[model samples]
Target: MRRLGSALLAVGMLVGCGPGTQAETPPESAPSAEQQQQAPILTTTNVDVAIECSGILEFANTASYTLLDRYLPSNVVTNIVNRRATAPFTSLADLSSVPLVGPTRLKQLEGGARTMDFIDADCVGILDGIAISRDDQTAIVNLVNTIDDSELHDVLPDAWNGAVNLLNTRPFTTAQQIADTAGIGDVSFRNIRNSATLSRPLEALFTAINAIPSNGSYGATTLRHFDWWNIASANHYYRDQKECFGLEPTSVPYGASIRPNLANAAEVRAEVQRAFDYVGGNTKVSAAVRDAGFANLDALIQGRSFKGCILTYENDPWSRNTVHIYVDTVNGFSVMTETWWAE
Candidate 1:
């Protein structure tokens, strides 16, 4: 099982981050002692993410739908929305009194106050990697994958320990199952069910790239030396093939060490040089890789990914906004920035 079983409330959790994007920033405060105890201990369900029931407006992505159906079902989501037709929900409790939401669901609602695991209803990306759509709704933006436990601490410090502890002990299949068995507040479950997926928000993105019918026209990038999109596509197939089976996702480790045969060498070279810009100074990136024991650019990226070669800066230096890197690892040349699942 994945170490972050708790990180994914759904699917193999988040996958395949885009290049050039930054990692989630670390927080100013550690989670309060209280929050550390209540966070949801979750696992990927490889389930389809339900649509957004933003409560602010009828979702537009689906021409015929208007609410999320992953948690319970469409009829139920519709009922809750219909009841609150006049206003947006301020909290999950708005539905606590609804018929289907009995004491158990209510408990989930109450828990929202202490801990949350889903994307905010206001968030703009697809949720939990399910790819389900809410009618008329666009996907959320800047959504971070919550599947990485180390990253989770900054965003939800309160639940970080719970997520970690749970991940260490068990592997779960559904958010509802985790909530019921793990006692994650019912509301937290609702948050995950209601929120956008944390999985790599790039399926549509990569698909669009592959569909470009690139017999050669679509794969080029300005960076000049490499095929960024091609690498991303290769990375996708390597990771998604397993996710297609619904098994726990095995993370693609940073390469055993940078070596000449690495697939994403071009992009890795570009980013390693770029790392010097943010961190500052002519020798920053050089020093970074050199300190790690490599000197020249080719040697620096020989068997590794940008993950090890670049210095992690305060502003989510982990993100590669324009390029994705693949390393020679278990997932077999998978990128580390985002999450992906076989839909």
Candidate 2:
């Protein structure tokens, strides 16, 4: 039940819409009406980020051998786990005590730590408010205790009346109380648990938005607008196919036929801000939240992750160097920009 579910795909329209690290100015030609119709629908998946810690030290205390192996070799992972079993780690220095976790690997772990989540109840201080079902019962309890009635109902449409009543009671001491007080059946309770997955907070979304570099290497600039061709081309490619762009074969198997367009950094950032607001339930951007799967901004963001891919133009003009940004959203809201040429 803790595993990620299938990414729900809905065929929806592409609406158009970055910079920095800087790419060459792009030439533009609008897509034909028929081409516009053919543009790709934004793709969506249930956001399910894995648990991670803020730093290597925290990871040492919490990560199982399997998770540790992601950062260390099996031998190193075994040593770390065994060492921790005998004496818990109190700091990063302790990791070096484990065989094979040399200074180089330790530094790599330090860098990788930023990408991980810290869900250990004993370790998580501020992050305790965020919850996923896989975390201890306390996380589930916190979720049921804190979620908005409207959001609860949205996640469990079948239990609307119960959801409102569940919210009114306030501060349920245990996760089980949710079902008991609301009269929501086992099915609804399971729905609540399943929906409890959320890895980050609302603020993290802004952090990611701000993190889109002003200039990326490989002629990658902040994306300004995604033309109809980019939209249609991107739609034809799935995450892996697009990700494979920089590797070779000159063209994507997904059938993307044109080079990407890059433009003004400020304009692209502004558009991304608008997209974030629209997705976050800020009605100023749109009357409705674009995706029904998410009850609110928090719902969309909790388990979400953003991925970027590099497209190189080494062999063909059609294969212009570009960066593609993907978010787990109903509209795909995907956009691209030219990047520096890749070798």
Candidate 3:
């Protein structure tokens, strides 16, 4: 059950989240009536899930360089992997294209933990979202758990103060629900993207921690599915109060330094506007159709990037000739493509 002043319960100031969505930019998570009506079955475990998902690069493509360097056939690493730097392997499937990630090696990767759950989907351009299975709890928790309590003071004040209260509440299907509720800001999300983690099998990790529950606590239960906010939020993140997506100060340079390709966020936003404006002006598109496109863009741009960021792509099937945008502030960078024709 939720605490007395939990953000969700006390988000009395309702404000529109944009043009399309039902949730407002207040301290309330966006659970539908059905979700709210259903009583939550909370599970508490003294055991913590040891692993999240693979780190940024792994989600984008493969496991860490060290893992690949050690695991892949020595011949393959020398002939195919080492040269990838100059060529830049975009996806794990590209390994096949690179020539040495042959059938035997691919099979090895499939059975192994190092390269197992990489999200390598086809992308025509900038990816809009990253698809992660709920079973891949590691990645979901990794990104969400990165935002620290200290930062939340300004970034998500409501969440920081009411962390315990919020956890006493129900499940969240999407991080956006919590972010939208707390009215999270851009600075917080960006600061958060800089700190993330990963790499360990879910089953083994659970088995290890769950071997014994602590202090008469119930065993921990995690979500079956948790999508990256295409944005970020702490409320949607903390499955339990003790975990912060490992948000404490860290010294891991690789995860700490990763970021998206956009050189400037403002420039990217301007380009997004110009693309939509051009689509809205298309004579071939009916006035109603054109207006409809703008409306979709309005909701997407406003709400889509609220938690994370919106990625733009060229020749997207979503529009006739306009750009297709992907809103992902979830995994920091380089997971994989989750393409959608959603206008």
Candidate 4:
């Protein structure tokens, strides 16, 4: 993903007495003893960026104003300074402490830290090894759908060139789709998959505390049952990628951009029990759980799987107490938290 190349051209002006083009420095200005003794410890063609978790933490805690200003927006740098004043950042997840720092900004910060070194030793960060985040999915989908000849060659190595021209057809759904289209051999298939994965966008993950309903009863229920990662992803955040406890929510700038916080899922059995309790405890909830062959909340939690339910409250104005459950494979167990608030 990182490539380095540079070119230097020098032209020497000859003096009146010189037949060959050779420029010599005047003896007096040639070198000073002190200046000659000074040696640079590092040399680099480009800035060294830190992509690892610890490296990012170091940058957040120690980066100077000049360095921060070079990469982050002025307002964001101010927010970072203000937050750091309260406490030094503890983890990559603590990035949520700085407002306007999300997927995009995180990428900039990761590759922004500079050092006088030719190679970056801290570029070991990856989004996720086993599971792909939403950002990863979007980037991969885009790349496969729109790779040009040069881009295709650049992404895949020489061994994969055989399968390169075969990808001219548009819109590939998965690695398997490309393999099928090209009728590539096993090696080509493996190469394509590896390239696709390596080509996914690399960004630092911050623990994004998902917004819950203002009603405390509903909020507690949502957290206790549903997977936090699932909820954060539903809110369009990349979380649960790291192990960090007690993360704080970022402060949104007043009169700035504000997006709606919405989460929805299907076949939520145990996840909906507590919410159902707050809504006068629906019988369908129990029936769904029972029908799923789970005796109680403990059983459902221990060995939870997909289960559906449809609840409609006619008397209530908000949501009209309507909860519709369809078959969703995105997450096995999830709860829908829909909150409506005014400015």
Candidate 4 global CA lDDT score = 0.36
* lDDT, residue 165, model 2: 76
lDDT (CA) per prediction:
0.30, 0.40, 0.30, 0.36
Model with the higher TM-score, candidate 2 or 3? 2
Model 4 bad stretches (over 4 Å): 1-51, 91-93, 114-343
Please report the candidate that would top lDDT against the real structure.
Answer: 2
Q: List, residue by residue over 227-276, the lDDT tens digit for candidate 1.
A: 22233323321222211111112322222222333345566545444432
In model 4, which range of ten residues has the least summed lDDT?
Answer: 200-209
Across 165-277, the per-residue lDDT of candidate 3 in tens digits comes to 32333244443333333433333332222222221222222233233333331122111113333212212221211111212234111122223342233433454444333
**Residue 136, model 1, lDDT:** 14
TM-scores, all candidates, are 0.26, 0.26, 0.20, 0.26
Q: What lDDT would candidate 3 get against the real structure?
A: 0.30
Determine the backbone clash count of candidate 1.
Answer: 55
Evaluated at residue 59, the lDDT of candidate 1 is: 23
lDDT of 3 at 247: 28
TM-score of 3: 0.20
Arranged by lDDT with the best first, the candidates are 2, 4, 3, 1
